[model samples]
Target: MLRERVAETIYVFTSSRYLEVAAGLIMTPQGCVVVDTLPFPSESRQMYEFARRNCPAGIRWVVNTHFHADHIYGNYLFEGIPIIAHEETRAMLERVGEQALEEAKQETPELREVRLRLPDITYRGRAAIRLADYNIELIHAPGHSSDCTMVYIEEEKILFAGDAVLPVPYIVGGDLNQMLATLQKVQSLNLESIVQGHGGVLLRGEIPETLEAAINYLKKVRSFVHNAVSKGASERELLAWDVEKAGLSRVPLGGMAQELHRANLLYLYRSFQKERLRRAG
Candidate 1:
């Protein structure tokens, strides 16, 4: 069921296992704009029904913050709708979306079939759409992914930041510098509320402080990797070094420490390789 957080204006739809992540819906007189469609079709339908009852106008726009399966798999649920997303997002979806859906089907036969539908409308830098009651601004924040974008409600001052601003470092496949730059760009926005693709909503006032912490964490991870590389540490050794430096040995395998820190290490490794190549050149 969708929980009414700020009335019909904003709603949260969550999954059982994915408690850290919640899809958001914005209601307007014209229709409803959904941000980050959940992974499963059932969850998407639940969100759709909630929005229909709350708005009843229709779903005019569906925004896939990124090309992640969990975010865009629900696009099939809103087929024929004018889905809007970043240009990179559309490209990535076209490239890998089908494979993701097929893989999911093989893994979960009981789940409803969801097709991979690329966004019909895509914007490069930024795009602003005027809905029935509010203006939705799509800002390109390429951190977590090349196509990651943040949805900003201008009047409400609420930003639906995809996986860009999470509580922990979830830098699975991204450039560390680019992600840091994206976070800096997001910090510059005049936002009153920050909603992450994963994790609960955060007030705007808390953003600056939280952003600082995130940046510092990334820097520390980078430093650790750089120093280890300088000492000719292997990947396995680097992993152990990270565990000691970050004090992440206690968290569960699938928990924040493991997932987030693993991604951070991968990013650090890539960054180190790039720096080494530049120095060699």
Candidate 2:
């Protein structure tokens, strides 16, 4: 795990490599508010200790940016602090949290130490969480996942953007269009920096280009998928299509990149087919 302080009270922890997700910590006058916990129990414990030593306040709350295993599997470490997230996030976790944990365990032995904790506090739309001196706003950002949320600290002007703004955008919620909109919303914000879910933080100067890159990639994928489906192309052919020629070379299909790519193609294909059937009916 790597740690860098974005502001006096804000810090970003990321591994930048495989099997690890970035997490953020916000210190307030009252206590420390964690944006999202790391993937493993030991890493979570390390972050907890880091908070105890650096911030006067301990962990007051744990926020789930999304229900992905890399972000929420270490929730058990903060058992007392209320885990906060979007209402849909909680629901999705309730539906698939355990299965996700089981699958994660198969990939990594570290997850065996994780206890699979879900959200204690949930909300819809936008919600403002006020700490002693920090104004953290939870905004619903659905694209990468239907329940993905971004945490913005008003004072620091920094955003914990979750998986919504990774080096390569991953579209799992069947809404590549919405994903672009979500990033556009972030682009409109008065942010000094953005802490991405799996990679390095983006400074103010780098924000626009990153957002544009992601938007272009999603647009290309959506357009290509739509055209292919209209022409009755098979999913296999779509998978074999040259992603770079289609303008998705910047997106790192890392980890299970191939699986994610295959899933995205099928998702768009199925969506177009269903729309066609609905229209015909």
- Clash counts per candidate, in order, are 1, 0
Worst 10 residues of 1 by lDDT: 247-256
Candidate that would win on TM-score: 2
TM-scores for every candidate against the unseen true structure: 0.89, 0.91
Q: State the C-alpha lDDT per candidate.
A: 0.77, 0.82
lDDT for each residue of candidate 1 in 1-281, tens digit (9 for 90 to 100): 34547443777675654545667888888888888778777778888777777778887888889998777777777767789999999888778777777777888874446777889899999998898769999999987888888988888888888888877756777777788898888878887788877767778567788788778877788788888778777778766644436643434324565566866786678678778889989
Residue pairs with backbone atoms closer than 3 Å in model 1 (clashes): 20-199
For candidate 2, lDDT tens digit of each residue in 42-142? 77788888988877756788899988878887788877889999998899988988887888788888777777788999999999889897789999999
